[model samples]
Target chain A: MLYFTAMSDDNTLYEDLLRIRRFEEAVLDNFPKGVFFGTTHTYLGQEANAVGVLDDIHSGDIVFSNHRGHGHFLAYGGDIRSLFAELMGKTTGVCGGRGGSQHLQWQNFYSNGVQGGIIPIATGMALAEKRKYSDAIVIAFMGDGTLGEGVVYEALNMASLWQAPILFVLENNRIAQTTPIEMAVAGDISARFKAFNIMVRELDSSDVKEILPVAAELIAEVRSLKSPRTLILNTYRFGPHSKGDDIRDKHEIDQLRVERDPILIHAHRLDSNHKEAIELKVEKYIQEAFNQALADPLPDASKALTGSINHQ
Target chain B: MPTVLYALNAALQNALASDERVVIMGEDILDPYGGAFKVTRGLSDSFPDRVITTPISEAGIVGIAAGMALRGLLPVVEIMFGDFITLIADQVINHAAKFRWMYNDQVRVPIVIRTPMGGRRGYGPTHSQTMEKFFIGVPGLRVLAPNTFSDPGDLLSKAIFEDNDPVLFIENKLLYLNTIHDSNRLSEFEFFEQTPEPNFYHHSKHNGTIADLSNNYAPTCMLSLRDAPPPVLTIAAYGYISEFAYQAALNLAYEYEVFTELVYPTQLSPCDMGAILSSTKRTGRLLVVEEGTHNLGWGAEVIAQTAENLGSRLLSARRIAALNLPIPASGPLEEAVLPGIEHIIQAAQKMV
Candidate 1:
């Protein structure tokens, strides 16, 4: 049950989380100043969800992201420079400046074209992988807000009925932008897929120690089902969703953090001094990554207009 | 010799005959009832196992095709109508367009989306819609519309053979049953023991002619702007309206000595800029003709871009696309709403 005893020592995981937090902080610091025009839905507080899940993901296993996908993209071994380029809308960006932050993509495995947009895309990819990988699976990250979209449920129904190799990871941070989960969505969410005979699970997401094992178990169970499965990761948004807002709702984020910080949950479980050292190290790492991102060149003013229309 | 649908059938047959890997998927594309348009006809008999039918779910069909293509299976998924394409637009735009670029060029969504577009049969709004301008904004998706059967057969062959990207092949319903021959070149599928010499081919002539009526075109004389009498305006059109534009332009030339030229485009998506640019250069004034509803329609793009690029220079520019409304299902109402020769004449007069 204790699959992820303490990954704080894992250099790669810590570096990834630290890098994401810092990178996004830098994005926020520069956005209003006209330094970055692309809309970046920063993935700050949900680092553990991305790292814990993506760490176990095979490189061959296709990954799709929602608007808040910086964590998922970076955790899934995507390069940081391209991520930066994407936010800045540069030709060197993954999509050659065509797709900005929200549309960051590289190949079929990388479709950030719309919100909840990549669910069916992931299913489509899973349909491709079903015969070939046999063992591997497609993991799609969806926000709680996206469940309302028709295509999400449609793709899920088709995936379950056909028994496609897909894992629908619902990142229910309890808010769809400004609307709370209870306000935005109604009734039993798990029963949604269960009605279709697809397996569903909801887990407390603040604790990676708790979250990671559940993920591994559900992932295994879904893989065993060889059918579609939905795992709802009930986390909290610690940041303002993005940097544009300095304050997330008090009850929505502050109260949750006081009760359970994704990093704090893991840190508390470590040795007292070891926890202090991790905090210091993570702080130092976040600070440096943030600094580097700030120092990074703001995309050229012409970059935003690069891919419009060719009249000349 | 085959119609556009027959050409689609020929392409499917040729590709299936060449590779066991090709599979056709859509609604009612099976043997007992070839596709709604009969493009997949006879192929069910030729390749029974490869032809698949599904519940009338456009989203599910295209999503599955996107999946199948990733697995290295060439699935030419067909939608019953162009209007139904909007149901699966999210899948095509989000997945088919972004996959290869999102994953760092790792996954190839080699999907060929085949569907029929446009209006002529009085099907009206729900059944008659065109999808070119909207899809052009999608970056990773390659859009192609065929003017003749050979283009579909050859372009489809290339889409299936080499291009590892997603391609959208639009077939006009009018073109489906109409017999067409290209004097330009021979399709790879059109292998003739004795090839017709290029010089010997004659352009189909129209003596006081009228364009085909089945495609919603009006009877009009076809001629170039250079031959036109002194006229104050010109209009460009594509598909069924090409003929109407020609007719209206000729009438305008005679009635008011107004010069007008029709810019006929058989290809819709990735709109033919070459012809549009050249025609705009000559007349210096344009009114695009489209039968689709006006709001967020195809001709809007032409107007917008022309205004942005050539606004200051051109004499004037405007779009005469259909008024925004669900195309009327009734015969008379649909005809009134869609563009015709009379509409072209009036548009030319107003512009002049």
Candidate 2:
């Protein structure tokens, strides 16, 4: 069993949250400048969900994320430079630039653009770990939009039926792209999971400190029982679904940003001097990642067809 | 006694018993239920821990199989019907087929997708259809179908252990109950006087004069002749339609005096172009037959490659396949849509 030790001066939690927030902000800033090639679903306001949940992820454990997966990738220790390189379509990227932002795959970390596709894949990975008698669990991260897909339910049923060691983290921001959750989802999400006999734990994503203890407990339960569980993080996305889709009202978005800003809330916990030092360090790190990734050369078009198909 | 269905069961049983990493997952594959087609009967009872009964989720099954394969397990997934393959096409085409190459050859998806295809059961458009054409050109996938000459047991075992790539093992519904008999077996010619001198042309590279004489199941042609004469036309077919091609060859040998050779290729995707080119060079005319619809079908691919390779040496080439339309529920309508032995004979005659 793992326990969270929050010392009075410990800044790891705050730094993790700040790194994702700052990195995504850097990506958004570079988007309009045409530095990054394709669209990226920013994990702007949902940093606590990824940081808090992935705090307990073991080294051997695997993680699968959705389209809005930059934060999950970073929180799980994905290389920031390679991630920026991937967004820029460089050969030094995680997937050698073939897979863009939505399709980032590194060691023990994978993300796909398709909704509900990774749940079953994560469950299978958990099944493999279980069969091998390894204690490593799998964490599959999805948003409220993924609940609309039928494959998620199928995966949930299998995960529960097989008692796979998987922690399904649902970052329920109550919105699916431009559409609100009320317009899309039907009934109680937790009740639906309970019907499948999976244990459900709801966590408030407004504060990383509050999310850490609960996430650690749930992770321990999944690891001990080797059973499927869910941690529904009630959060909100501060930015648009993508770069060019700011359909939400500015007044409402500003209110949520002020009331539930994860970064500010965590920063308030730190001393003034400590917060300043951490922010400066995180900013410099993000800047270096951006500059290094920009300096990297683009992939050669002549060798584009090399790894398209593998033969025996 | 070794029917196609039993041969499949034997192959699956051998895989499960041989490797601890081998696992079977599908809907209704558990014991008592066996499977939709009973190909997995008694498997669960014998290897209870390995054979997993899954929900009716094609995409989930395939996606999970891909994950398992990536994590060092040889997973054999059974998609109950061929038509349902469309449900898992994204996982098959995008994920399973692309994972090895897209991931820079770091992983091997040693997975076998076993599904029953073809339309003769009057099961209607959605259920009964030969949709193997859709998966033919997929780069990383090996699409194969078993015929009379090839044993499903051996083919499936090879797919499981020998190859590191994913294989789409298509089993025809009609051939499930059919017995596996080699026409050239000694028991087949027991009544003949002096063993009825073997009268056929074997490729110099291949030593087998008859299908039964071969020790291994490789892609090869079996020529049926009235006398020791060169074939005028080479009729190539696979899966269920190969039975029709064999019948047409025999009929042409007896009636038209058009000595014909029948080519049955077990592996269809990376088809054995060497043997096919050799046979087509000897017999300048070629007729390709398949149960899939004619428009851009497997037959089209065979003809295209043969024409490109043979060039002027190939005299004429034609293809006989199902009409480009949905299979109907009525027996006669299904028959009308599908290509039969008469269609094969007519197409061969035109080429001759």
Candidate 3:
């Protein structure tokens, strides 16, 4: 079922996973210095979910990401400097600094801060491409917390009934802010998608090698069949939810970090020298992006406040 | 002889036939049912590929339509009842409306959400309510309502094809059966038309003063009675309530010998205040009528805006709106709560 088996031979996937890990670390480290504005959800431990799924995205494929979307944006080949500038609220940032870390729109990729809101939008975009008879598909990323929103089920019903060309990647980190998944979600997650007749694939791994092959198969099947599919990635989050707000036990978090770190799990597959080279390059790249973003000028307050009131 | 419903249907037909990218998505909007209010009649049969009958999910329907709009398609969503707009407020306010500006003009959501608002049919509290007051001041949203006073089809078409923002097209439930009032029919009241430019016409009764401003979008109408002294008060109303306001103006003139100028606006938000201001300035008095409840409603916003601008020149101003209570299901109770032609006439008579 895996179509792009040759992709496993290259070190690009290793670099992609490292890039997200390092970039998020920089965001958390500098957030105390007041370099970024508003709130940000770091994609600390979910690097494989983004790098594995988005590695072989088609040219016209669209990606709809959620609040914790820095990893998805980076894996989509988004410009690192502009993304950093967006977090810094600079005029040269993506979306002109209007959409901060949670809300970003660049090229064919879009992300919103609201949970479960992007599901229907992504389904509709997939339907649009299907109606046009275009070979394009859509990828929508959702979190476990979004399961509480009623609109998610509403969209899933239509996505299956309409047979939209979409791949719904559910990154269930098993915690919603401060509440654990056991306290929130009842029954099973895969059964929710299966009830709508959408085919579901469940994987509980952090290694990019295990995730990439399954994502390639599901993504290819969605394009060829022009129907909706779900990929439930049971993942983990290493950092606090956002800006130091973790209530989980320190020992449990540290234990999971040692066992399920996506970068560390994938690094063992590469040669020692090659892995060190990738790590050094990614560290330098993250630093330069952050420095350039810090130097950029903030948006003009006087002019930025003008256009929204005049709705002509 | 086209009814308001026929005109709205024609607008949808024309837009779907003219552009291949125009899509119609809603519940029960197919050929047999043709939507809850029948505004989308015959559209599904005509454009089979474009017309989509969706599930009974108001929020999901709007979100899907917004996605279609973001990807360069003109999607017109029909929310069966206007009261259900509460479900889709997040999608319209946070997502679709803010997409263009939030994205810094990188994309635009050209969507038209047509819903049947207002209550005269006794559809009860939940089904029969005018809810535009909740969305009047929304920044990136255009709230448009068409009546028999002008061509509803033309206004609907403008929202679908011309505007590049998200539009909430309000169609009053009672107005669907009413026939359009042709401009030439105003001759019965000694009315004369003045076309300052093509597609822009101003009609005024004999001896009534009119504003000189030009509106590029739908223009507001100023209705006054013939053979009466200059208006002592100006009445501002919109949607289905405008019809009753005009009737009250006529009754106030002939029955009570009280003259009042009536101003009806189709565009609720970004309202063209020039016409209302001109009439109010001449009269020195204003009365705003609304079908929705009075407290913090559209009428209050209008009165606030006009008062802020007019200051001391506006000698007196009042609002005639529904009682501050839920619209009862009983016919008599609903009538007792809602404002009607009798209420308007009484208000105008006392104001004068």
What are the iRMS values of all candidates? Answer: 7.9, 6.2, 4.4
* Alpha-carbon local distance difference test for all models: 0.65, 0.82, 0.86
Q: What TM-score, computed on C-alpha atoms, does each candidate reach?
A: 0.76, 0.90, 0.95
Per-residue alpha-carbon lDDT of model 3 for B1-352, expressed as tens digits?
Answer: 7999999999999999988889999989999888888989899899998999988999999999999888878899999999999999999988998887788777778799999998778889999888998887887788888877788999888777666678899999999999988877875353322211423343321123221112236657777776768889999998888889878877787788888888888888865566788788899899999999989987787888789889998988889999988778999999998998998887777776
Model 1, position B334, has a per-residue lDDT of: 74
> What tens-digit string does per-residue lDDT give for candidate 1 at A1-312?
334333334444555566666667767776887756556677667777887766665546767777787777777776666666656655466564556676655543454646655666577667656655467677888888887887777677778766888888888887777677888888988887787777887887665555666666666655666677777887777777655554455675667767766665555555667555655775675565444544565445565433222111
Give DockQ for candidates 1 onward, in order: 0.19, 0.27, 0.42
Give me the overall lDDT of model 2: 0.82
Comparing to the true complex, what docking class would candidate 3 get? acceptable
User: Candidate 1, which CAPRI tier?
Assistant: incorrect
lDDT of 2 by residue, B138-197 (tens): 878888898766566878887777666778999999999988765556231111111112
True contacts reproduced, candidate 2? 0.43
Best by lDDT: 3
Q: For candidate 3, list the clashing residue pairs, or say none.
A: none
